[model samples]
Structures are given as C-alpha cells and as structure tokens.
Target: MASTVSIGNGYGQLLRTRGAWTYLLPGFAARQPFAMLTISIVLLVQHTTGSYGAAGAVAAVTGVSMALFAPWSGRLADRHGQRAVLIPGVLGHTASGLTLTALALAHAPLWALFAAAVPTGASVPHIGPMVRARWGVTLKGSPLLTTAAAFESVTDELTFVVGPLLATALCTTVNPAAGLVTEASLTLLGGLLFAARKSTQPPVAAAGHARVEHASALRVPGVRVLIVAFLGIGSVFGGMQVSLAAFTESLGEPGLNGVLYGTFAAGNMLSGLVCGALAWRTAPQQRLVVGYGALALTASGLWAAHSVLVLAGLGLLVGMCIAPALITGYTLVESLVPAGARTEAFTWLTGAVALGQAAAVTAAGQLEDHLWGGSGFLVPMGGTLLALATLLALRSRLAVRPRSRTVARGVGHRVPVAVD
Candidate 1:
C-alpha cells in the first residue's frame, strides 16, 4: 500500500504541474500528423503512380526537407516566440498537405507530386521542441523537469505507434487521400490550439540580446558528440522499422506490420513512464551511457530470432532502452546550452534523428532486398554499437557537477531582462 501511494503521488505530481497538460496535449496532437505524413505520402504516391520507387523518392525528399527546415523554425521560435512561428508554420503546412491531396486525387503528374511535397515537409512547425521548451521554462531547476522530459519522450513513442496504424488503416480502407486529409485536419486543429496557449509559452529573447548571438549550441563541449550519438540511436529506430516490415512480409503477414511496430513503441512508452517515476541515483550522462549500452545488447537479440513471435518479443526488449536514452539526451542538451537558444538546440537534435533514420531506412531497404531474412536487423545493432562507442569516448565532455545551493538559488532568481 505504501508503494502504491508513492506511485500515485508521482502521477499526481505530473498532473499538478502548472500548465503541463495544456501545452503537452496539443503538442502531442500536432506531432501525430508528422508521424503520419511520411507513410501516408508513400502509400498515396504508390497507389497513384503504381511505383514503390516513386513513392520512396517522394518520401525521402519530404523527410530531408523537414530535417533541414526544423532548426530554422526552432530558431525563429527562440527569437519570435512559439505562437508567432507555429501559427504561420502550421497554416502553410496544412495548405501544402491540401495541395498534395488535391494533386493525388486529380492524378496529377509524378513531378507535380514531388514538387508539392517540398513545402509540405518544410513547413512542419517543430512542435516537439516548442513543447519541450515550454516544459523547460515552466519546470526549470525542478527535479520534475526530468519527469516532464520523460513524458514528452513517451508522447513521441505513442504518436509513432498510433499515427502509422491510423494512417495505414485510413489508406487501406477509406482511401489514400483520406489519410493525408486527416493529417492536415489534425495539424490545423492541434496547431491552432497549441498556439492559443500563450501563457505557457517561453519568453522570447530580444533580437539584439547579446546571448542571442552566443556561439551555436553545436559549439558546446559535448553537444556535437551527443548529436552524433543521437544520430546513431535514430538509425536504430529506422533500421528496426524497415527490418520489421521486411520480417513481417516474409511471414506472409504484411498487414501485421503496424501491430509489430506498435508493440515496439509500446515497450518504449511503458519503460519511459516507469523510468520517469523512479528517483535516479546516477547523473543524466551516466544514465545515457547505460541506456546506449543496454540498447546495443538488446538489439543484438534480433540475430537469434527467426520467427515473428520471437522478433516481436525482442523488439519489446530493445525498446525498453529508447526513452531513457532520449530523456537523458534532451536533459543533457538543456544543461549544455544557454536558455536563449534552447529551442534551436532541441530542434537540431530532432533533425539529427530524422536524418539518421532516413539514411538507415534507405540502407536497410537495400540490404533487405538483397540479403536473406533477418540480416537487415544487423544495421540497428551496428548503429547501437556506434552510439555506445561515441558516448563512452566522449563521456568526459558530458559531465556536470552538482551546483551549490547558494549558487543554484542565485542563478534561479535571475529574471529575463531585455537587452539593447
């Protein structure tokens, strides 16, 4: 009973945190469309063009566009505020989605489809970083900030789990256009709702603020190393996705792809919540190292599994390390960068993940096409090994000694004064 009460208190703390749900819910909703967008585009383009090659090309372009533009959007939010950036970004993104859908329905030329995809991808609002920046501001200097980061990680897992399933269902049953249209509608509604919550938004730094011109977060001691580590981690996800699809197809149950993928995400979501609830004795950097090592170990299990059931079970096991790594990674970024550039720093992390996933997916697809079953799974295992190596080699740069209470208090009390 005592343990039960403690668990309940953890949840209570999450709920009572001011404006937590208000910012998080819409952020969660908005991210679903992004999660849905790539798969929907692939399905839609394939259905119309009858060419998986065409579909893959368009999806790759979309992914690249979003990865390139996300940091720019985040930089604008850091300067102009989330509301200023998100509203226009979301609107343009929605408009682009609509245009793409219209083109698809009208049987427009393949070149036209690719052209519309550029803006649709480029206009994504960087919702992940925006919500996280809000949490950083609201929960600064509090232990609960770790929990909040974990919550966001869980939201990411859930979005990936649900979004693809929903997109697949809509594309297969209703129509390909239906999936894209739903993504657009959700983006508009969720973006507007998220933008409307101005009170929780982080205060923007003035244009002329000296700190706004501070050296890029990439210049921070361990940030570049962290980014590289995250890129490898992202490849783990991308490779697993493609590997699972190939694995399921070999089982003659291609439709079960969503189920298998969701199972992986479910493991991530569950582990994130549990990891967040516990008090950690280790520092964030240490936890991050452990997470990477564990991921590599678990991912290697894929080599032993020949059947779908065994593969799915191993996926769940591998997923357990994902959230802990991501939560620690984001928390480390927060500690490394100045407050003025937090959003952009976070978005860079997001973009790195996207690019890594894109690269891995492309490579994994080729391997699956040429090699025997389960061989493609080696890619993620290799990625996790690379991540572990990078983290260990650069571990010294990520260290953060605990601050004295007096210094912590003094730093916490400083207000954001405008600079000329």
Candidate 2:
C-alpha cells in the first residue's frame, strides 16, 4: 500500500510538470469502460446465438478489421484528429453494435459478420499510446509520460481481467440481451466522451509533410525492430493464457483455473505498478532490455514452481516487470517517431500486441493438443518463449538502435534516449 502511494505521488509530481492532467482524465475514464464493453459484446453474442462458430466469426472479423485498418486508421487520427477522426470511428462502432444486435438476433450470416465487425475495427483503441505520445510532445523530457504509460498498463490489465468476468456475470444473472445492450451503451458513451475532450486530440505533424511523414515513419529502422519484438513478446504472453487453461484442467483442478489466473493477473498488476514507481537511472533502452529479461527469467521460474500457490506468487513478481517494460517500449515508439505519425505509432504498438497475443493463443492450443496436460504443455512452451526473449535481449543493441549513437557522430552533446 505504501509503495502504491509512493508511486502515485511520483506520478502526480510528473504530471504536475505538464499541468494537463485534468485534460486527460476524461479520456482515461472513457477508454477502460469501453474496453470492458467490447469484451462483453463478444461474450454476449456467443451466448445469445448458442453457437461458438458465430461468436468466433464475430471475434475474427472484429480482430481482422483492426489489424487490416489500424495503421491507416491511425494515419487518419494523426491527420484529422480527435474530433474528425476518433469521433467518426466511435460513431461507427456504436452504430455497428446497435445494428449487429438486430442482425445477429435475426440470424444473419457471412457478410453480416463483416458488417457487424466493421465499426469495432475502425475505432481507435483506448488512448494509451496516443496519450503517451501527446505527453511526449507536450512535456518533452519529463518522466510524466512514462508514469502515465505505467498507469495505462495498470488499466489495461485490470480491464482485460475483469471485463469477461463482468460480462459472464451479467449474461448469466440478468438477461443476455440486456448484457449486450449494456455493452453497446457503454462503448458508445465512453468513446463519445473521449473524442469530445479537447486535450485528447493528439499532437500534429509539421506542415506539408503528413503523407510523406507517415511513409517515412514506417521506414524507420527502430520502428521495424520494435514491431518484431512486440510480435515475439505478444505471442508468448497470449499463448500463456491458453497454456494456463490446459494446465489447470489437466491437473484435475478445473475449479482452480480461475484462481490460478487471478493470481497471474494480480502478479502482473503488482509488478507493473511497482516497476513504474521506481525512479530508475537506467536508459530507456536498458530498461527495455531489463524488462524483457525479467519476463524471460520469470518464464523459466514459473516452469520450476511445483504448486499453484508458488507459481502464482512468482507470476506476480514477474508481472511487476511487465508494465515498466511496456512503458519503455511505448516511449521508444513515441520518441523516435516523427510528430505526424503519433496516432499510427500508438496503433502499431497496440496492433503488434494484439497480433502477438492472437498468434500465441492459437499456437499454444495446438501444442496442448499434443501434450498430456497443461503442466506438461507449459514447460516446453515457457522454454521457447524464454529463449526467444533472451535472444532478443542479447541482440537488442542491433535490433533497437538508440538515437545517441547518431548524436555522437553528428554533435559533441549526448543525444537523449527515451526508452528505458
């Protein structure tokens, strides 16, 4: 509790430097509630239709829509902004949700799946990365942005962990249709609030260089490398969810599954908060390396724990490192990126995470089919992830080229690096 307080104080001080904390509050509140609703929508659709196939189609279409259009949508956000870009995206999602409820209830198929998911695809994600970039631009050199990233990670973990559970409760206890309606209303309301705010608008790129700038942003070596890293990390974490499911069921403690998962999440939350609070001297690059290295180490440690309790505890410890690392990674994307690409940059970060998580879950499930149980399944799985993380960390210098190296050649002064 003391540590949490300390962290909050540190974060508050950092935000004070910008004097724009209030400006971001509305966006933050709006974002998390919408995420909860999105998850609920998936669960509700599955329940109402009584077909996992229909449900899966919805999830797939929604996911694919985001992956395909995220970069471009982000580009739009960067160009047109919160009012023009984000609001339209939000409106699309809201209208789609309303229409989909009717179409789904009517038993529409095929093209309807695409139609229903289009709006969910088009909307900007919860404002985590964009907010970080805005802070980076407005409060240049202040640590407030990193602290905000930490806070964003906290909300992310919480929203994901709590969201499905809340959905399940609503569907099972109340009318399933009501649950869907609740989800729709929340998403529409929250997103509208987010776009309506003035400060929520992201920073602008310099004049006459928007299109050329967006293209060049992709060409950035640092961006490409970071994306690769995101893929590996996201895949592993995503797969771990699947692995956990297999492990609990195989251990003949299916009831313990939720408990184990809860602990895993608790660990992530604790670690993220603690790490974010620590006033570190390490460069963001070094912090990023340390962050991944911690995950790799924890992966192996998790494999070694013999019981659920021990594993849960270690998972929490490992999770502590996750948010700070993510914060560092997002900061890297924000710093090296040009002004025009902030929206796109944030989306790329999230999309990378989404891609990795999706791949990991699929691969893990396949691997589990060939294994005895989850315990047997996760060992090899953890090993693979740990090895990859280690390799990436070792080669990070090559993969993540710091800006300072260039500064040394061009100027005598040390160039600032924002990653750790």
Best by TM-score: 1
lDDT of 2 by residue, 6-96 (tens): 7758766766754456546655544543334433444456556654334544654555556556677677667767556666666666677
* Candidate 1 wrong stretches, greater than 4 Å: 1-5, 46-54, 102-112, 207-214, 373-375, 401-420
- Model 2, backbone clash pairs (residues 3+ apart or across chains), number: 6
Reference-based TM-score of each model? 0.87, 0.75
Cα lDDT, model 2, residue 295: 66
List model 1 lDDT by residue over 1-420, tens digit each: 001125466667876987778877888889976578876776677678775445656666676778788778887788788899999988999999999889987889878887998899888777888888888888778777777787788888888789877887787678878879999988998999999999999887655673543335555656777787778777776677667766776787766767877888889889888876777777888888888899989987786689878888988988887888888888887776677667888888887777676666666666776777777688788888987888899898888644221111132343232221
Best by lDDT: 1
In order, candidate lDDTs are 0.77, 0.57
The residue ranges of model 2 lying beyond 4 angstroms of the native Cα positions read: 1-8, 15-23, 33-58, 98-115, 124-126, 175-181, 209-215, 240-262, 297-318, 361-420
List clashing residue pairs in candidate 1: none
Error of 1 at 216 (Å): 2.2
lDDT of 1 at 211: 50
For candidate 2, the TM-score is 0.75
Pairs with steric clashes in candidate 2: 247-374, 267-316, 271-320, 284-419, 284-420, 285-420
What are the C-alpha RMSDs, in order, of all predicted structures? Answer: 5.1, 5.9
